[model samples]
Target: MAAIEPEATGFEPESAVRKMSGFSLKPAERRALLTILCALLAVRILAMFWYPFVDSTEARYAEIARKMLETGDWITPQFDYGVPFWGKPPLHTWMSALGMKIFGVSHFGARFLFLIASLGLLAVCYVWVRKLRGHDLALVAIAVMASAGLFYGASAFVVTDMAMVLGTTMSMAGFYACLADKSSHRVWGYLFFAGLAVGLLAKGPVAVVLTGIPIFLWVVIGNRWRQLLRLPWITGTLLTGLIALPWYLLAEAKTPGFLNYFIIGEHYKRFLETGWQGDLYGSAHARAKGMIWVYGFIAFLPWVLFAPALATRGRQVLEIFRKDRTGWHSYLLAWTLSPLILFTPAANILPAYVLPGIPAAAILLVSVWAGIFGQPGRKTRAWVAVSMIGVAVVVFGLTTVAFFFPNTLNVRSERELVQKALETSPDIAINYWGDRSYSAEFYTQGRLRYIADSATLEALKSNDVRDALAVYSHDIPRLKDRLEAGFVDLGRFNRRHLFVEPPLQ
Candidate 1:
């Protein structure tokens, strides 16, 4: 992708009021993007406390990090006391553990690193796009991304996707810099490798695939086979290997057979095999291949409403399917489309899996917006305001539900149950049977334990551990006999129930 010389375009608008897609830039464009970014962050920060840790994902990650802090074992993330968490590398856990150490093991602390990564991603996207596309488009890109529901959601949410997105953004930006600008400095090449290293630590080999495949496709399509030589491959590979290999080696050494489980089971089988039957630590999502694109619309949110405008670029979009014009448009298309293609056949696809492509999607939208509204004196300001208002309405509606009527959001009730259990027996350990809530483990600072069935639970009650609290859901009716014989009811909240052995007189 070659940069179009500014002289050839003859459209050098003044910085003070650059007209884009018929909308005036009002000199405060940079401030507007920043203001939007800040507002998005404020909403997410509010959400950190307003919502409980979502179980099976957010709480799971936070609990593992808490255990890492507790045991002082930084090498291996722990799902249980001795169970090595093989799902992901420990980079996120390391950052989260440090946050827990500083902020205390709470939701804010657990999510602090993701917040920073999200901000870093914003900064990187703005800087990188402004460098290539210009300040106006860069500002629009940031504004569009900040307004996106998934991109904004991941900012304060406890997830590894933002970290991965940050790395992918850097890697793709660096590649764009090197490939599009023949005179690009050595730093761009270095940033490319740095991104690879960070991405490897962030999400393993999947990062490499996500970063490498697009570039490979772009180079082959553009016939810039020579551009490959210009990159410092040997040095970059060495740098990436040096930065990324140690932890993997250490993890494999610490936990025998970790490589097979993480690499083959998680990376390979998870994508290729429906349901990922090989998964050891977690269940596979197992959705239809088309759901990846369906998630794309949801992930991009209000921007996807501009589908008609995008369809006008139908020929350009199809160019990604074959060798075509070699320019920033093609690069953006490759960067945006590759992920959809890569994940289309995946057995377990997540909305966040498409996050790496979001920056490119935002860029594409900005390009389309600029083209469609490029005519002078087009009153687009009101439309932009309407878009922001729509976002605000959605955000306000969600926050209201979270704050005023939390129980209505049953997806997060597990953590509320755990919080109730802790309120009753703050000093006693909590144990559950039938089902385990990761939120309980996190809220309890990893003190939540599990037993197999009524017999094991009764054995604990017969011992001095009788003071331990037993927590479960409405499913506790199945264990009515056990509860009647050995335990006294504590309380019930929503669908959750709590029980404890009677105190000796």
Candidate 2:
């Protein structure tokens, strides 16, 4: 081949240059960006449709949102029966309720809002990394987050995790902006708004504890303690109270013991007790070191390989701060590590509980990538290319297994019983083995009516039902033994021995 022209090698030809320098994108580059964004969106959409609503938590949240929409109740979020749901705040419910109103109570509809939130997260990551690192490294961070399994799973569900992620990301971004503009009251105002929004959306006051405390400590310890009092505290507090008060007031009125149960009992007591924990993993304080390792492995999938370099670069950045007496890197490090330490005392922990750390981790990884590969060098380019290819391969394999694998992999026979119920009585009320009804409702599209033996049964006894489905478990044996006369077993659906009512003769 002929030798490359100097203009062609170093820069575009003068005549071919159509726009401003530095930020101007060529046609091919624009197309590539659009393609990548579209592909990510398509993956999220497809995954939302493909995954069966897993029961218990995810399904329950969706059902509660659906009911909230149907009943036009925004104050108290309920599921199955009108039992108190003290697990999470109501922002996710609000989002899902909106989805139900718009899309009319489908899995895709309930989860669509989360998909949008995930997209917002992805966009935030891109902007954040671009600000700290360069465009190339930002792209790498985006790719890593897009391909992570936990990220994908949460993005495709109607859960608080996505909202938490969005709020936390916003908080982190605002923190960074506030640091950059300490003299500007407007920046502080924005930071306060973001913190308030996140606090209301997440596990209440803990949001401020998790985010603000670390940031404050970082600033104070770094000799910038004077800056703390400069924030627009009065205005910010009023704004936050305004956003958060209505729900608390309404919930307190509707549920007599809501404050005692929610704030003190559920939030505080759950953090202290291990036995009452509802997490798939045990309590936070009781978590083994291995659990944290596993969380790192899963949450940073396809990107975990780069973690070593990321950590090394993060340390170097911290070293620079130590020498210069600036606390920027220290703030990030504290934000990342504080929650890990704080939540360790809680009775329950989840991979998503540590999700707030994701942006900080992404920034670290992007910085590392930039430091190693920002220059035009053969070895750097080769490493970057190899890493990209490896990540793409792993992501493709995992998504293939996750999406195409049989239901037998993740779901149990209880789910199959729900599936059978869907086929037979698509609209009949179902009495569950307690809070376990969502497993059925998720699969059945909120079509099954729930009857808890103690409360709902008394209310639903008047309804006409020649046959009813009772979920059998050790606790609900009475439902199996005390059946109405002329009841015929339709067929055993699964190992749990679910039976359907036959048509009245």
Supply candidate 2's per-residue lDDT for 302: 52
TM-score of every prediction relative to native: 0.89, 0.77
Clashing pairs in 2: 283-347, 283-348, 284-346, 284-347, 284-348, 285-344, 285-346
- Per residue, candidate 2 scores C-alpha lDDT tens digits across 411-434 of 432455665665776665455544
Off by over 4 Å in 1: 1-24, 28-33, 181-184, 312-326, 375-379, 464-474, 485-491, 501-504
Cand. 2 Cα-lDDT: 0.60
Write the residue-wise lDDT of candidate 1 on 1-505 in tens digits: 4433323322233443244224335566456646766666677787776767777788788888889999999999988899999989888888788888999888788888888887888788887766555677677777788778788778777777788888888898887676545555356777899899888898888988998888888777667676666578889889888989999999999999999988888888898888767776678998987788988888888888777865887775555333323356677778887779889989798888888888888887776566554531224545554665577567766866866666675555456556656565566657776567777777777676788766776676567654544555656768787777877786764456677666545
Each candidate's number of clashing pairs is 3, 7
How accurate locally is residue 44 in candidate 2, as Cα lDDT from 0 to 100? 62
Q: Which ten residues in a row have the lowest lDDT in candidate 1?
A: 3-12
C-alpha-based local distance difference test score of model 1: 0.74
